[model samples]
Target chain A: MAVTLSQDGRFHRQLIFINGLLPMVLMGFDAWRGKLGVNPAEFVTRATGVMTLVFLVLTLLVTPLRKLLGWNWLLKQRRLLGLFAFFYCCGHLLTYLAFDRDWQLGTVFEDVVKRRFIAVGMFSFALMVPLAVTSTNAMIKKLGGARWAQLHRLTYYITIGGVLHYYMIVKSDATYPLWFAAVVVVLLGYRVVVSLRKARERVAVGVER
Target chain B: MNPISKIPSSEITPEETFLNRRFFMKTAIWAGSAVATGGMYRAFSPRSDVKSTGSEIATVVDSTFQSSLGADEKVNSFGEIAGYNNYYEFSTDKSAVAAKAKDFVTDPWSVEVGGLVGKPRVFGLEDLLKMESEERVYRFRCVEGWSMVIPWVGFPLAKLLSLVEPRSEATHVAFETYYDLKQMPDAGSAGIDLPYVEGLRMDEAMHPLTLLATGLYGKTLPNQNGAPIRLVVPWKYGFKSIKSVVKITLTNREPPTTWSLANPGEYGFYSNVNPKVDHPRWSQAKERRIGEAGSRETLMFNGYEAQVAHLYAGMNFEEDF
Candidate 1:
């Protein structure tokens, strides 16, 4: 698939569309079939959260995959993937507001203040708004590459907020959040290690000079 | 991969076709004979297994007595009552009591009555049930946090304690539940103190709001529900109504309770379902109407404030809370 997708925009688009929407469709079908037993509101909330994390990870992988494997096509799909992450994050917030809070804005505000989980989730959602807004090619050009990259760095903080939100809201099981945290750690760990190595190389070069 | 005709004669066998035909005939005959025999049995035999009454199999036996509730009663029936639970030891989950409490053994359940009473005696559940009049009706409110109107049928707690004839040393009455961790499984596992003990002032115990319940919705109490007997304090949070009760100690001084001891700032022995007194963690002003049976506003003192509020009129709820 990677060999064929080297020059193929259509193939990458197909991959993005299927990866972004298939899980949602399957979950929706299961819900409509009454297989989820209870209200399925929590299920939707959980699924959206997980997919948000998944797309965030995929978006982060773009730079590394391009650098290592010389697949520039991965860079073209980053914006789409990041937008999809925000889309699911919006769905996550919507499910909580609609089913959990009944869309009572007053109560939603109360929850944002009163519950720590809501605060964390709202923060993650807030971070996504800017990322989604700047995802367009025109905005990217307007912001310029350096400033845009700096702004998008907020996604790391968004990932942390998302994980904490999930962890705090879960009353019993920590396994899912624990797994997500571990994955986030590994991904973020890669970036930190690369940065540190680059810093050491720059220092060593300076000393040699 | 080759066609079947390419096989050797030795491997095929001359009698193979004949044996196969015979086997098919035998299978057909046996199946036909079995069906014919089953039909004959159905035709001649009495329909003992058939539910001609058009009722479901009773997983629980029906109670001989009715709730015979007071004038202000609001609920009835086993289906409605049994679904509602107030077991806090198993966590706040509504199904927790029913699911986790099966591990509790109420077989040799007995209550020790002492202190300030003229007749201090230990009474088994069987003996206690014999003394009380049985009636089933909805009683609601729990501390693990939920509300349900249940069809409960047992004599008033006041009526039974009167048999003991207090000598008036009982300024405060304390109730103790079975404390055996071996028998009551969730006692230590819940991360909350187990064998929960709750107390009421002597007047509160003798009040009409207190009940020593044995059965509900016209049947023996299910094993998960303290089985043989439990207390029902309709005005208090469900935790105040101790389950699998085995002892009653009337004291000259106020007795310590599980929640008060566990979190002094939160739960008090006088843990009445008052809308005004909010729990430290959440509001007691409102409660989710479980089973979605009726979305009625949760009442003050679970709507029994008129009957129970006066007991704590001079006292501070926030202090003890």
Candidate 2:
């Protein structure tokens, strides 16, 4: 905090941009060099899926961090992180459809309907579509502040569903998924405590008045 | 997860050719570059790295029980076969298994035979080796939907069971692998019940294809690939082929298996490879061969139906699975 750079500076945004794209660039290099492991398709799918979850966690951290430190520019960074989460989600789904399902839409549809894990994953991805569409400045303005904030609340449910999707898919080990669940729970728990405190403060003010 | 999985057998020198002088120099060059690049052939490349000196290499003297199945499919290099493994007693990570199991001691191992058997004898490693050996090139299929072609060296399970003389009351054969909390320290965290067990009906156990393998690719079994002695039920999923086996019991009742016990809905006692019967969580209609990029549709009984389908004749595969 002693020597802070401007939170909304172009350099800061550029840094995030470069870092966000770095995973894909490295993955591409590995693919070109034939280094995506025994099952390259599996490697790509898992990498993109994990990246999506990582971005989702970062995206939710923005609101709490901004509230605690009073760094509102972090709000500006949130949308970009959310968008990157969506971007990796796209990659995850694309790899599964092309490599795993062989672009067989009928089978994929059946998978979505039949497999609980696939159904959960598809539900989360579908929830992301509306958030992504209303992410622009004009859409935010059209929806207005209170309405936009209410709609963007979907991130909480989407992140929960994302973790569930991961938990349900793994074979035996649930250690990674459990850790993801813990982080999301703590993040959500903060909001719950803050809201309760605010309500108590308002009741005290009303009694004094 | 090693990228050497993508290296085609065509690019690799054939087994006989790779054992020569020129190939030894090539291995050194490859080793230098692999170390410089920080990967690829670092751990078990060229297969010879794991076995130092010719005497340490395991050699199979006879080709007793050969199968023509998957002959067109090139046998995976010794590195690929030994490098990637699913021995849960060692580790769950396939690529990391070889390293974790390297220090494993397979000597002083003996398998006990009992329960409803007339002879019911324990055969040590030395005596087990005397029965016979074979080179079986079979398609290896994992329950998680991946595959490989392996040239396993062993004899039929019937050959070993014959020495014990199963009793008339015996209806099923139950096999259990050796489990030591100290020897396989990591197995405590493997998330499955230990002393991995598998079972087959008596007739199925006696089938010509049920192998008691001691090695692979003509070398003695590496620790990761179930050293000393292991079962090779090619028609069933890989888990049914229990590794590091210690006990064989002929029973009158169906024996509980590890995967089935872990998740009965997803894994069944009769986990034969079938294209029509998909796993509850994931589709098993197709599988990507380990070294290949694309997937091929799975075969019923893993393409050994002609030899094994009759075993499941009256049973409904969908219900049993």
Candidate 3:
């Protein structure tokens, strides 16, 4: 049997929060040690971008994995993972602004307008801001369950946008980006199938009555 | 006997410079595969701390390499230059290239200079090294918005091209890098197409500043840095400086280049470093000078417009880029 992390355990959630920050800590350590290679700016930007994608993909996996494994506790951990994704995306955008564009709003705006990938990435990040803001329990309560759930469905579009951003920016090897795209597609497919099955069962029950 | 130019022997980077990235290769070999990062670093912490916060590339700089800091152009430390490379033949991951290329066989190599040439010949590694070696300190800019100052030791590409004696119709020169399926396992997946090719107009090939570099920092190139032979076009983006070249062909038609063939929009045939023409993906207006903080304004023609501008005197920078 494999060692398992329980979905709702507070200890595991805390562990994950620390674990999420670990990469940045290591990056800072490497930067300090002069071990981040010759191009530290590129390193930070790339590292944060990669982390954003990793967390975003992992966030997408939560619902699917929870359904398959029957681990309802995974829902309790979803907010933390989703927030980390947002955090890393912020780092990614800021690193580009600071190092690549010299904190120039005009330059970064030009990039967003002229470059398709940057535009997609910024749009995804923009979508994430509302998701992060509404993630609070109070906001969820105020919006009511059904409306909040409906709005949160935008996660699918945001994830798709993130994958598109990655696919467009890669120089040649689309292998990794393609892999991410495939996984996101499957995750989205699962939801569509589940909803269609539920609708068919509801119709069958009505006909029998 | 040909007279040679060299960086002063007094400025040779100490042996400690060799100890950094090679640590991974050694550990990977011992383990017969990749190991965890912490173990690798523990096994290879070669540099001692100076004033000891364990932070700062400047402090880690070898005294020999540090002396050049006073000069207007500080030549990057040998380790820093070699450790960060973009040899797409091995992999697209720049820093990972060193470990992947550690065991590459460069000794028994030959470059075939043939197409549209009068005297076709394949020059062995030894024969190529026999040419005069000159040390030129150049600012190397990449399309991805990063740059480095390197002291490259090699003879001009003109010296080798002249030997081949191109026919009157040979208007362009195409170059290719050495690609072995066994040695370069990552070539198949390295984003761009393999057997990397680059072209220069025949006049560009013969220009005095265009170099055929074999080494840097007064030493033979570490395998990661295109050992044995590579083209060093200082004015163009660094990718134009093809590495570990194994083939050179002179042609009447403009030759197809690797990056341009992969994606025509981002890269172009004449990838001269023009700040006015930005890469569609990133701004070329400014670049992060490697090993330094903050971005600096990128120079037109990488600050070599005075030297090589006449070649493109009539061409438009926007379209050519």
Candidate 4:
């Protein structure tokens, strides 16, 4: 299918942005209304963490979705999804630091060292910083598309790390994290299949020539 | 006016006049008001020690039993105690439990006390209530690294065990929580073995501090806080205090607990609140007290060392944990 810039494409882009901002606004409202449930700190922290993983998974889905369903407009939403993932991750970290730790840097540092899940979660968040910074078109052009794509590949590791962190933190019932893992596997598998098919096509063309 | 005058004035009096006709009726109303006022006065009176608030769980405070609180201890608000819980049989999310557990029917509940006991018996909710119960303020420590000071209203486990008459071979007391897939949606889905089971050594079961709580903060337990009855082993991690218990078996061998069965390495059978011992996933040295901003240093045996330390005197703390 041929990709085209149409009115529908512009509308979809706006929808994606609205979808990303909706949760942030709802979370703020929930927090304000004291509706964050029993443990507000933990509720916010887990909510943001789950949101981050959700957006990360959604961001990973864009390429496969476009390829499989021929929804070319999905490519435009990928950056929006990635940025939303980063935004929620930052919220997750802030909830931990401000509400959970009460800005006690020493305790937070000790936790990062002592707790394996926290350590992994922090590391994953740190890796996201550069990707988020270079997500802009200007920075992408500055770094060159080849190098930018290579740097952005860190998302795979970050997603894996986020899932692992989630899996480790739960006391029991790994259902949600397991589902996330399955999704990640499927997305990555799609990418592998597509690349293999493209390689086969290139070889076939070369042989025909 | 002429028609009204034709009627007898005494008979045509207002309804208020009829209400005041009999002295007995007047006295009855006065007595009823006095009783209502007296009941309210007693409920709110500072001198009235037993303060039973209206709640769904139906708790009755025993006035004879006595309990005192430590200087530093503070009772967590009933809202906090009831609102925040980890009744995984209902749900894993702490907040979801309160609402989800509303579907649970705690009335008409009975617990079967059997196995290795000479006189095994099935005790109904009322039968359990008949036993002497007291209000005790205790520090509750969860294995998830959170702590709360809860005012529990119940009797010692030893009193109930003694009535059952455990056999000479009985070395441990095992507990099982209620399980009904129709009622507890998460019971089938939480990935834990159904009918959550917990146990304590015979000595621990007979300990004076081990209470079977039915109420908190002078109110009947909220469904989320384990309505009808539950265990309250203050020195042990919160999971050790099984909730909505349906069965208790006295056995020679150790009983498998829910968490220990789920992950043996992470959760041990004892599950005593020891700062020196850490859960495989997280540290137990410090704990965030619910309703507090920052964490506090966890105490050995949750500050009941003097009472429970001798129980585990020879055992290795790290291994047993």
TM-score of each candidate structure, all chains considered together? 0.64, 0.86, 0.85, 0.83
Best by TM-score: 2
DockQ of each model against the real complex? Answer: 0.04, 0.14, 0.25, 0.13
Kindly report which residue pairs in candidate 4 clash with one another: none
TM-score of candidate 1 on Cα atoms, chains taken together: 0.64
Candidate 2 per-residue lDDT, tens place, B186-281, comes to 688787888899999999899999899887776678888898889999988998999989999999999999999999988998899998998988
TM-score for candidate 2, please give it.
0.86
lDDT of 4 by residue, A18-134 (tens): 656666666677667655544566767787898899899998988887777887778877888899999999999998888656687789888888789999999999999999999
Model 1 lDDT tens row, A9-68: 765676566656756665676666644322244346666787788788788788777877
The second chain of candidate 3 has a TM-score of 0.78
lDDT string, candidate 4, B117-137, tens digits = 989999998898777677887
**Among the candidates, what TM-score does chain A have in each?**
0.92, 0.94, 0.92, 0.90
What is the Cα-based lDDT of residue A195 in candidate 2? 94
Candidate 3 ranges beyond 4 A from true positions: A1-8, B1-71
lDDT of each: 0.68, 0.81, 0.79, 0.81
- By TM-score rank, best first, the candidates go 2, 3, 4, 1
Over B1-321, each residue of candidate 1 has an lDDT whose tens digit, in order, gives 769878987786556665676557656655665555445423322111111111221232344633333454445334334434545555333333455565566666778888889998888866776764555354577653456667665777887788788876678888777666565545555545666778888888888757787766556577556667788888788777777787888888888887787777677778877777766444566554444422334577787766778887787767755
